[model samples]
Target: MNIFDRSKHIYLSPDFEEIIKDTIRFFNGTPVHSISIAERFHGTGVYAIYSIAKTGIYSKFHLVNRTAFHIPIYIGKAVPKGWRQARQGLSENTRSYELNNRIREHSRSINLGEGLDIGDFFCRFMILEGKEGDLIGTVEAALIRKYQPIWNTLIDGFGNHDPGKGRYEQAKSDWDVCHPGRSWADKCQGVPANQEVLLQSIENFMAGLNSEEDA
Candidate 1:
């Protein structure tokens, strides 16, 4: 079974139903990236992330090519909370850091590695204003299920942060194996499968997808 199949819900309000349809429509539109839209994005939202490569760097992964662009690689949600949350009585401008910050962090990750280019990434997103966490999660989960993102499904840990203090004993994530150089990830134990093994697994998964589509 798919890892996310257990999360099932039957009821949906008309507003939320409309939001879901809107999110899907947004994904079908042209993708945008943080570099070009930096000033435009400043709010809590769910984003559909995509990646492309002009060279051999990402050629091993299972990605669909659209002219120069490649497949959607990940889906993420960013809410204002914890350290990044807007304090009470803050202005409207102050409440919009969550989504932009998360996207910047991802851009940093792509640029940190010499083999990858930040210019290759783009996203389709919706700014979720006055939306609760459950609704935001519902949209993100729906997109992940629809795309079956490579980073979200086979190679994990694209969303991980530094495990502070005494939490470095666990094995490193599959994502780190495939794309390294996140400084905090250096202290963790390595996954059993190396980059080549993970690549093979992606190949097998893509083959399964083709089989299902053909059948």
Candidate 2:
């Protein structure tokens, strides 16, 4: 007879794993919509932004999403205000429109980009209200892991908000460097990253994605 102690290892129960898988499937099954239309809805949950632009730097993403949105440029979540403070009950009535506002905000950011267009970006979102809202972060993280979106993994800071008054001394984000047009980002006292280096990083990331597909 062989004896093994299950307590020695940490793992999610099969049921929990299945729940995650189901959530991912639910998210993927959601309708793909334009970022321009995001302001028409309200809720809190996870979303994926896809780019089908033919920009030279983003040609790989364009190619992948041209026929089908198999790649996401970014994945993110919007959670109810105060949910993090264990005051979820209060959040229920707040009607903050977190998800809608977040997606709209992304549209504004893209509109401000030097060479980006809102029409070239599309999104798929799942609005997990009430108890399901708790899964927002988990679903976003899982999708990001599965897709390795460039905005989430490589070119960071696409989700950043204004640093407010005293935080102007912070360095500009890589996203700001690559797509600079946000007025507030200009006030950041630190120098932006080198464009060439950021482009190289993007190329390397695309190469890895290609290698994975070939495998």
- Highest TM-score: give the candidate number: 2
Model 1 lDDT tens row, 79-154: 7565244443346566567778887787787777545677767766767766344467778888888778888988
Q: Cα lDDT of all candidates, in order?
A: 0.68, 0.85
Candidate 1: segments with Cα more than 4 A from true spot: 1-19, 34-37, 60-63, 68-70, 82-93, 132-134, 190-192, 205-215
Name the lDDT value of residue 59 in candidate 1. Answer: 47
The C-alpha local distance difference test score for the whole of candidate 1 amounts to: 0.68
Alpha-carbon RMSD, each predicted model: 6.7, 3.9
